[model samples]
Target: MHPALIPEKHPMCGKYMEALVQCRKDNRFSRYIGACNDITYDLSLCLVKEKKIARADRQAQWHDQWRKKKEEDEARMLALKEQAAMSKSESPKEVSSEMQQL
Candidate 1:
């Protein structure tokens, strides 16, 4: 997107970046550059499944989508944990803090 991404959340990006760098170091930069479509396609498929959108329109949208997806997922997980805690006679806050550590 902006040549910056949270690698931990985008495993495909990290994988692609590693391959791109290796290609460049191996004097195959032109090959990777020429395969931009393949890169976008691969990333798009992965990101789409994560409820994110990555396209040529703009980079900020991609970042926003990713951030939104991440927050939604975390909230859903917290809600589930709270529900489980409620059934187990445990504190929601304590369960929530434990979920954060994970």
Candidate 2:
């Protein structure tokens, strides 16, 4: 058997190596390099890349949500201002003119 296929003193090494080979075959060189350097291949640089991608996705989602909330808040404030202006108007004619200006 290939040295890479051999189990370390434990049964889990075989499974781990198989996964590592697959990672290499998949062109995930960062993971392969990590596996090559680490004894158990459990703490690889691939994980860092994965985490970075996940974090970026989360940040993008948060930014989108924040933008939507900001738009909603602006809309709410505008509505409140309009309502207040209408309420403060001295006459119905003034209210119509103000609404048209808006």
Candidate 3:
């Protein structure tokens, strides 16, 4: 499995659906094949539900990281602008002469 694609843990953590499927596959309830099939179907539904929850959690984390980085960048830009403004105020004549020279 690709490292990025691999789930950190079984997607069905805390879910009993896998155990139900395994019991059916193992023929634990041999007397009723219909019951086994029903259990398997239920397991499939649980798996889908767990996967959706995991996917949403991962997306939320990704967006949070992006938001934090964006905020840091904006703060840095504002600091730089403030520093430039302060320096310009302290040396207005020099800056004006330099602009004329340019």
Best by TM-score: 2
Off by over 4 Å in 2: 1-44, 91-102
Q: List where candidate 3 sits over 4 angstroms from the true fold.
A: 1-48, 93-102
Model 3, position 91: C-alpha lDDT score: 100
Clashing pairs in 1: none
Worst 10 residues of 3 by lDDT: 1-10
Please identify model 1 stretches exceeding 4 Å from their true place.
Answer: 1-57, 90-102
Model 2, range 2-102, lDDT digits (tens) per residue?
Answer: 24344453353456666656666665566545544443345344444545777999999999999999999999999999998877775788878899999
lDDT of 1 by residue, 9-93 (tens): 7765677655545554665556645645565466556666544443544677778899999999999999999998788776777
Q: Candidate 2 versus the native: TM-score?
A: 0.44
- In terms of lDDT, model 3 sits at 0.68
Better of 2 and 3 by lDDT: 3
TM-score of each: 0.32, 0.44, 0.44
lDDT of each: 0.66, 0.64, 0.68
Q: Which is superior by lDDT, 1 or 2?
A: 1
The alpha-carbon lDDT assigned to residue 55 of candidate 3 equals 96
RMSD of 2: 12.2
**Could you give me the TM-score of model 1 versus the true structure?**
0.32
